[model samples]
Target: MIELLTPNEMQLADRLTIDSGIDGYALMQRAGEAVSQTIVAQWPDTKIVAVLCGTGSNGGDGYITARLLKVAGYQVTCFTAGRSAPQSYSERAQRDYVADEGVIMPLETFKADEFQLIIDALLGTGLTRNVEGKIAACIDEVNSCNKPVCAIDLPSGVSGKSGQPMGIAVKADLTVTFFRKKPGHVLQPGRALCGVIRLCDIGIEAEVLEQIKPILFESWPNLWGALLPDHNPDSNKFRRGHVAVFCGNVWSTGAARLSATGAARSGAGLVTVVAPENALTVLASHLTSIMIEPLGNDTEKLDTDVLSFFKRRKVKAAVLGPGFGDQERAKRLVYTVLQSKTEDSDLKTLVLDADAITAFKDHPLVLFAAIEKSGLQLVITPHEGEFQRLFGNFVKGKDKVEQAREAARLSHSIVIYKGADTVIAAPDGRAVINGNGNVLLATAGSGDVLTGIIASFCAQGMPVFAAACAAVWMHAETAECFEELSPAGMMAEDISQMLLKVWARLREMATPSPSPST
Candidate 1:
């Protein structure tokens, strides 16, 4: 689980490292040397290189890079942006480059056609305002060249804190970042703009992270693998945990079945699909290992039957939404489930997704109030559209991570904001950005499959936030495996079946190794 730092955190890390012992300029030299080495390795045949330097430390690194490239016999042209004189480390880097006989060109004289490789050091992670005037023009020219570009820290004009582009940004073929990666490196628009990211160690020791103590991490097995339920020899079916999935109407029963299968395959001991009487036949025919229970079409009976099953089976978790229609009845079912309880135990977990999330769009506070009363560990899975509907005016312009964190805080539930870059935020403020998953997961019924996976983990005694992180990573791993067979043709059911393989690998990883012979 690699730590993801924000721009402010990264600045503090650098300051702390310099204060500890290492010279700031020495770190800049190392960064320049690393970038120079990478360029030579990636493009051995390159002759001319254009280095676009800003007026700050990012430009300092570019200056040193230009000097190193010149020493290696490459025709290097250094272009400096802005009218201010280089200060601090950048001043030293410029003086050294000039001593080495490297010519620093003005932005107006720099030509994109003259170079084979373009190094975008125009702006670094500290940039907050939109790119405008000369800097923006320089970025525009570099992008228009269509030549391969290598960014120094991050692509010029990309927000290091948020992954958003500031008006316009340079789309680099490769990005070289020093020390640890920033949130922008893994987040959406910035991740896309940064083609291939290469992390270079520039003399910052690992211990610096101890003082910074970044809360966000890249989603991986090491982050939440230890939290998975153990299947001991003495474990029984009931001990493993039971999951109940609320089915949609007769015409839309497949979604519920998908959720049930996902729950069963994800290590839930028993999975039952609580369906309306009209949908029982379809669900029973589609499911074999999973059980099906019928609740009459009457809303009053449906509420009573669901509560009765929760008490009778000691159900650990429940999944709602999916193909369930978005109507008053669906909203009523959510309310009933939240309000229902067992005599001796509270409803441990619940997953609300798709139509279930949209059902409370107009009055989300009512749902929040019920969750507060029920004391249920809740997980809400919402894609972009659903998130917009549920969160409404609160998350209009916030970034994905911020949006999820705020939503989690407001509802006091784990919020899984789904996308290419899925972010799982807990109410206490810990968040993880999923690094796994592929484009193949964009297929239909994928969210339904995710709903089951998360609920199953929660039912198996994993904490709500950890369960969500594990489910997201496993879902991505399943998609990665499915990609090997058929990238485009694989369906949601394929992912459910592939969970067995993913779980096998996870179990193998968790097993203790044999001790060495004495």
Candidate 2:
């Protein structure tokens, strides 16, 4: 897993290098030269460049980049915010460079649009406060210019740890950070402002990532490759795992059937849909590979019968949600499903989504209590509206990732905050931001597909934390495959077919590259 450093942690890395006998000034030069190289590559025809310098080491980086950009035949204009020079070694080098040949323009005298590309070096990772006074005005000017801006290290006023904009921040066209990326580069607002990201290595040891130990990760196939279940040559149907799903009424049975198909397609050995007796005929006619079980029509009868059926079949895992109505009957059904237990063991896994999450809107504590009492794995998938109904209004204006993390901690369950950028958070502090999914997944029944995938992963003996992350990544990757296909007319079944394609691609990456046949 890659590490994303906070501002202070990144400073620790610099201190570590200085302690190892490398001169701080030499490190600054390398960083600045690398930034200069990036500028030329991106803007080869540009003859004018403006570098905004601050009062510290970030200013030093600006001076050096200015000198290097000047050497490459661009007219470089350097601007400084404070009067006194910084005391650091790198700062002294930057001051000396300006004294020799660079044109130091006062902040008030500099005009916007004088340069085609603005390089914002006003603040780096060291900044902890909001932008104010002349600095705020300068950032405002940059924002009003409408020209492309490249930020060094991080955007001028965004927090590296939280991705929050401090008062105001420089919205950059591209943000060139060193080594591994930071949270701000991926989190919202900051992520939206940072048009594109480029990570540069300036002699920082790759091993430094181990010491950082970031709790959040950018989700990719590499992270979930090994978590997928292995299908052995001798594997039997029972050995692979079975997932049982509860269907709603006749009109609402499609969701349950879709989920069963999704589970079956996602590698579940067997998927059974328990439908109300009235809906069994229609469901049976619709499903070929999935088995259909008859459920009693009345809530009390169904509740009593479900437990017996689950125990008799020795079902490995169960999915209860989807189109299950948000009424009292649905609530009773959900409670009965949660209470289902075996003679020798507890129900190890349960997935809740759709109307199931909505049913517990006024009494979220009941959901929490259920989790505490069961000592079983509980996974909740909620969209923004459902999230508000179930978890209350925990998120005010915070980014979705932060909101999801907080929800995961509060509920003490794996929280799948579903959206274009799905964030899955475990109670154990691990979180992932999925980048693979596109708007094509915004269609109806897509989430039901995801619900089935997670249920399948849990049935296959994968831990809830890993299963949640792997399932989310796979769901998103599947949607990305059909990016060109509009989500407008598509149904849930399309995503199940796409899952097979996603599985093939992921499996290829997991397997070792083939060698030539003898």
Candidate 3:
């Protein structure tokens, strides 16, 4: 797992190294030199360089970089926030560099139009408060200047803990961050503010992460590879996996069939839709390959006997709550499916969506215990409104990553926080910022398609944690593939059809055999 550290945690990590015999000043020297070299390499044609420095270590880094740039024959002027020098070794290095020949002018003295490149070293990761006074004014100047700006470490005024901007932040043309990328670097507004981020190794040994034990990890294929299901040539329908999607009453039954179709396409050899008796006839008229099972007459309680019929046929996964109405019986069925907790139980993976999520919104704690008792990995797909309804405002945070992480922790299940920038967070502190999806996915019922995609992967025995990641990645990639298609007109069924193409692409990309002998 690649660890992502908060600004405070990063400071503690640096402190830990200092106490372990490495001098802090040595790290600062290496950091400054690294930035200086990176600037020369990335933008050698710089005529005038304006370096902005604050009172902290970030300012120190800028001072050193400016001094190095000056020595390299580029005209450099240093602008300070008109604050005293920092006492730390990191701050001292920057302060000493500016003591000789570097102009110590206020932000007003520099005109944005005058410089070709502006290096922002103001207010690094440690800032926790909102930008104020001259700092805020300088940020406005940088934004208004429209000149190409390169930020050191992270863009100023963006919180490292969450991706939220502290009142205002510097929008950089490029951000050169050291070591690991922070949560801000990948999450929302921070990701946008940090333009074209380049991660440089500033000699912070990877081993130091072991002591800090960062709980957050960037999601990627490396983490989910083992969870990908392996299929044999001799695999039979039951041998692979069987999934049952529960449909709601007539008006709501389509979502369940969509899930069934998605599951069937996603490698589940046998996919069934359990529709309410009234809707069974209507469902049968549309669904061909998917078989429909009618619910028992005992409407108040889900018929365990009827469910056992599928169990006897060796159903391995179940998707509930998609189109199911938020009725008393729907709630009962959710509890019934989760009651089978034994290792040999037919249901090993459960996907809760739409109405199922609505049922638990009033009391999420009820589902958490049921999930633990069921001993099955659980996945919950909720849009922002549904998410807030289920988990309350506690899940709301400054960054989508933070909110999703909080939701995963509270629910004890994988939380697929659906949006144009969908984020999937697992309880184990792993998340993926889906980059492949396009605006075309913003249409209605798209989330239903996403829920089905994840359910299909879960049925194939992908751990709920990894299945969510794979589903999100594939879902987004599929949307990007069909960019020309009208997003406004796209429906859930369209995604069901596209799943196969996305999986084939993923398979081809993952396989590393010698190219065909041409």
Judged by lDDT relative to the true structure, which candidate is superior, 1 or 2? Answer: 1
Model 2: per-residue Cα lDDT over 1-518, one tens digit each: 34566677788777777777878888888888888999899989977888888877787888888888888899989888865464775467566767768888888766777888899988877567788989899999999997889898888998776677899999999888886677777666677777788888788775665565567777765666665688789998777788988888888887898889888888888889987778888898899988988887676577668777777766777887888864666677767776764333325788888888888888888877877666667899998789989875766765566678778877778899887667788876677777667667777888888888888888888777778888888888777777656545555678898887788787577533211110
Q: Tell me the deviation in Å of residue 66 in model 1.
A: 1.7
Off by over 4 Å in 1: 83-87, 504-518
**Distance from true position, residue 362, model 3, in Å?**
2.6
Instruction: Give lDDT per model, in order.
Output: 0.86, 0.78, 0.76
Error of 3 at 171 (Å): 2.0
| Model 3 residue 307 lDDT score | 54
For candidate 1, give the lDDT.
0.86
Candidate 3 lDDT by residue in tens digits, 257-371: 7778778877787888887688988898999988877776575455565456556767777888876875566678777777765525677777888888888777788888777
Pairs that collide in candidate 2 are none
Listed per candidate, the RMSD to the true structure in angstroms reads: 3.6, 4.3, 4.6
Worst 10 residues of 1 by lDDT: 509-518
lDDT of 1 by residue, 366-433 (tens): 88788777778899999999988988667777888999999988878999999989999988788889
Q: How much is 323 displaced in model 2, in angstroms? A: 2.4
> Model 3 lDDT vs. the true structure?
0.76
Output the lDDT of residue 337, model 1: 79
